[model samples]
Target: MSQTLDAAAVRSWCSLALDALGREREEIDAINVYPVADGDTGTNLYLTVESAAQAVEAVFAAHATGTTEPAPADAVRAMAHGALIGARGNSGTILAQLLRGMAQVLAPPAPGDGDHAARLAPALRRAAELARAAVAHPVEGTILTVASAAADAAEAAGADGRKAGGTRTDGTRTDVAATVRAAYAGARAALDATPDQLAVLGRAGVVDAGGRGLLAVLGALVRALTGEVPAVPPAGHRRPEEPAAPGPGSGPGAERDGGPAFEVIYLLEAGDAAVTRLRERLDALGDSLVVVGGDGLWNVHVHVDDAGAAVEAGVEAGRPYRIRITHFGATAEHPPEQVQRAVVAVVPGEGLAGLCAEAGATTVLARPGEPPASGELVEAIRRAHAREVVLLPNDAALRHTAAAAAEQARTEGVRVALIPTRAAVQGIAALAVHQPDRRFDEDVVAMTTAAGATRYAELAVAERQSWTMAGICQAGDVLGLIEGDVAVIGADLAATAEAVLTRMLAAGGELVTLVLGEDVPDGDALADRLERYVREGHLAVDTVVYRGGRQSVPLLVGVE
Candidate 1:
């Protein structure tokens, strides 16, 4: 008979869940059909669990400092809360709410009589209720089905325990363990039946990925009950490995260092204290800890057996922006033969695409209509055989997707980087300085620095009259965005453009490159106005280049 769960037990369960998630994430991502190509259900659930695990670790650490035993309920609640705030995408939101319900059921009064197993049934039931309420239209074959089945089975098992003259109401019931075990069994059965309920799943010849993801979670919980830790999936199940390290005297592009021995990387918010703390924690874990901090972000690379533990430590120090764990054996020692890099530009016109192609970016997944999906970006990179891919999301709306893609790639052993360039002009500037042979870190720095040096200006008409944008914007009003922020709004396009240009160029610019969108009147006309401004202001100008094309938006100009 199982008794109570300790902090270590909780950690074991969380780790197992994450391992299960890691094993199936890609499969779930590939089979999602209801939402079309926006299939991040697996990724979202994985991130959500990871966030919760970190929270649990923090709770445990805090409890260890005191005399009191770690409260499993409290730690679980913290994890659920973290998942709520860190949740992304539809599936992620639903998963967060489910965990929230679980937390609520597991809260306070401390399950009387130390009957940990009895509480599982009620918690499962609450999770189902919460998950059902989260979705506007709940589907039967997805996560909802699995959770519901588990909850119902737990209730049934509890009833059976009572019928057998076992302790059910005392909360000291050891029979509750049996109930949870039964629940997991029922949940697995329901998972197998998912395809029968949803025709789409049947047609796809696979069970619902979301449903399977929930099963994985339940499986972890069951494993915890059995005092077992889940193992990470073998390398074959993950992303392809990097090439082997080149031998001695291997040519210029030869593999080096026998494939990095192990590539350890993690993400955290950027700060001196955070970096210092992470360095200290990683030092104890392993060697070769390279700490890189930039743009309010930090990436810690360390080789260690405790990858998850290292991530947990980082989360305790600060909120993690992203987290990736990969073994050197899982990836090639050197870069692939064709390290094709693809760039996604969120510009609003055609000229940007041409410029992107000329800059050596073979495939350009333009966000012409709706925001591009992460899968689309992933597919583009895969199609390009991009060993080291650089994503340039020139629109703020698409920035999150790019960042998520980069995080996913890193997890899967792909060398991916994102340059948060907010405009096509900035992307163009960065592309101008890109070097194919440079190391990824160096290339990213060079491109980002180049983008930062350029000033941007654009002219566009408002699409709506809603009380949006702080009442400063109206229909037909010309709007100008400086570095992606709406800085000037007025009735005249040229005046707004001029004001933005003047502000951006105030820091002293040598040349101005104006790439007008299809909506703009004419590139030459705008260039002439800018040239006159430069001559009249006695500003030393080198040259004015004008180009016109269609893009995701209108009017992208870069001044250097």
Candidate 2:
């Protein structure tokens, strides 16, 4: 009986879903059993959804058209598209793909059918398929599995309804309320079984976080349809603060020689002519102009300094919509002290933070949590007052943020270098050889070389079933990675650790340093076994440092 969804319902569902994800973000991250402890799945999924929600809200406000039914297909499409470009980690990417597929199915036709429920059934099915395709290899007991089950259930509901003469031909049939309810039940059931299906979840005593996030979104959608808000618990994660207000010199007419401090964002609703003119005007103002979200609503995000001017320009173009202006300052800035240099690292866990700090890094930004903003990073470096700054973005997810920080710092006349270190182990290795007194260029070259020479080894669980370079990884298999590549897969952590160690030392290393991670089993026992290998003349020990805390991975630094 549902005809079309209004903007408010779409916004409400998205907000409810995000609230659910915010409550359980950390628990999902902890289920990462890969030798490396980059638990960012929960965080990534939440951010992806949050971006979509924001886009939906912007679109609704710009259009200002009222409807009490289900959300229009175009609205869903805009939200999906926004999430696609803003997606961060692997989980986020997969979720974005799912949204993209769903959007395609829900795309309006030439005639623009008003049957929202009918369109959604097909969209949900396509979403599942797209999500499965996004992964190199699909795995059960994961998000893919949950989505697939939900899609199948929805399809089944459609089929049952069709048999009862409720559906129509051309795939534009209506009356999907029963199907949606059935799909939700199926998805919830699948989510509950994730712990038993995946060993990491079993160990962590939780369901698959990504799967849970998808379930939350689905639950919200069902609630919107049924007019009943499900009692979904909040997912545990950091709440993103509302965008800050424009500063004293930050309004529309503000002028600066370099540019404004933050990027100004606003949504515009007008005809095509207005949009074209606005685009040309904003092009002259700043860079990174992403003007998306169509269907009488234009979601505008631009990097500009003159917030007031930008707002004026937008207002002049068309009706002013939901306005959110964030000030993203320049990336690079000069430091005061010529003797000291700062290195900013993006690593997870306290143990890695300690290691980076010991290695002359002034600041260590934790991952799988709220990463420091570019402005914050620049401020941190400026506070350190170092002459030259080096950024070690240990997590690949933080690379863009680090680059942005570096860019802002450079703009502020700070000497900053961003070393593309992908893992915490690499960051630690790079730091070991960093010479603070050396020339900046020389130090960068030396650190890059050291990072390349280092190898990583750790014991963890496989998050999904995929064919890695090492072998076929199952849901519960304990995995070990060497030099950023999967090295071993087995149930026994000690055995896998031994295999990784042997491979790392097979290159005839002179000295081996093993830094045991927090969740590593029996550090002393593992070290003792390694000692026997050293005594056998296989490798020499160079003082093994054991730190009991979370880190990227157990590292094996080969000292020549």
Candidate 3:
């Protein structure tokens, strides 16, 4: 039975591709040794398809809710645009152009012209050609090789099917599923042969990561059209890129070789002529120059020593924004082979920062009235000199900043998890359970759970008269805040601290942590008084205190 290519089929392909990539992300990332050994190819492909799927869904949603139905061209174009805007690394940028090339041939489906089904072969063929053309230095044994092979196989399949009397020359439905299956089969075959073509892959003892990702995407396309995934050859399953602390008899490693220092990517809005010149300039600057997308928009990717110069060339050509810079040698600060994992915490005061550092954390100090920027957090993560990291931004206002930092680190091939610690006390609670020997995900879960289970509070003096949750108080009055809001007001700092403690311990607590600032009325005396109050009232509650040093906020409190 033959199938016709419709808008629904295209939507399904995008969603299926995303799902397949998601399942294969870690494996693909592990095998990524080409261009640079900073592993992230699998993750990049998944993010690229995720963006495309979102755009396709948006088109379908509009058709479902509005009076007008979306056409096949609309869905395809949206997918291309989404990929262009959201493409991640080198492979992702090229993959976006490949999909865009397909749109170039199949969009605005011609009536009585056999629809998209008949055009699949030509679309794929063009996708391969365009993708190859987009790369300044097109190398075989990568995703480009797989894409080209897929297109060639699809064309060959169509030719054979026509001769076997399965022709659709009279403008009837074509065997779209057959075309997809052929493409997937060809990509799989090409993926297996990648090691022979690329010396890096051969040295790494793995197939091209980018090629494997493309194979998975093609497998999804086949699944969309045929209701079954293509049967890909099974390779001996093993993880070769898992990070481990340097030790004898640990990790199977490839031949160590250094490449470019940084990967710089950005979306540029420039004319084709400007892009042509920009390509030539960027090629001279570094390797892996994939200048994809066109018609006044382009996604630029390159690896270079001077990341600023790569971005500046885009500025000379046209407007480039969403600039992402990643140093390839993320673990340069530490011994290369010893690269393992670390925790990066943003703490407000010197005392907290020192405590975090003592617990084996890479601490980013946040001075009073100055929040750490996204770049600072990124640098701190890099300074940790580990392949994997857990980030704790111990302030409510820095959530967005922390998320952005995490995303930026991910592009540089660093696996960073951001734990939303709303206060320094929460960070402390999370750090208490930090176990580096545990699995990354397990450690993150333990930290997040501990942070969430703790209740945090702060005591400060009102600088000026203002309305409070308790009542309006004049300047110099003490304010007791539980979870960032004023809950009690008093004339004495020690009295206000005790009130906050009583309110927090009412629900029951096993441990109480107090960080007393320099402004505390006799730091040692205030902590002793609070410790006594907890002992006398909330029996069995253990208390720990730290000298917070010079800080604007008088006291930091937490109950767990």
TM-scores for all predictions: 0.48, 0.42, 0.60
TM for candidate 2 is: 0.42
Off by over 4 Å in 2: 1-3, 6-8, 30-37, 64-71, 110-113, 166-173, 231-560
Indicate which candidate wins on TM-score.
3
**TM match of model 3 to true structure:** 0.60
**Residue lDDT tens for model 2, 1-560:** 12244445556667777776666665665543211124545665676777777667667776676654335665777678667544544456567777777777766652445566666667888888767754544567778888888888888887787788844554556565576688888888887777578644454445666777787778878776666555553332222331234335432223222544555555467776787788777778765454543456555555566777778888888865334454323211211335567777765666656677777676544533234444446545655567688888766666787898898788768899888876666777788888888889999999988776765555667878999887799997978876557878888766676677677777766456666666666777877876675656562544355462655444333332
TM-score pick, better of 1 and 3: 3
| Model 3 CA deviation exceeding 4 Å by range | 67-69, 167-173, 234-258, 331-560
Q: How would you encode candidate 3's per-residue C-alpha lDDT over 1-560 as one tens digit per residue?
A: 12555778778888888877767776787777777766678777877887788778878987887776678899889889878877878899989999999999988656575467879999999999999999998998999999999999999988887888755555455577778888888888898888779766655557888888888878877877778867755421332552224234222233224457888998898999999999999999889999899889899999888998998999999988556677765532223453567889988777777788899998876656546656558767766778899999999999998998899899989999999999989999999999988899999999999999999999888899999888898999989999988999999989888999999999999999999887666788888899999999978999999887656598999999
For model 1, the run of ten residues with the poorest summed lDDT: 233-242
For model 2, where is the 10-residue window of minimal lDDT? 328-337
Best lDDT among the predictions, by candidate number? 3
Estimate candidate 1's alpha-carbon lDDT, on a 0 to 1 scale.
0.64
- Model 3 lDDT on a 0 to 1 scale: 0.82
Candidate 2 residue 167 Cα shift, in angstroms, is 8.6
Give the Cα error of residue 391 in candidate 2, in Å: 18
Model 1: how far is 268 from its true place, Å?
23
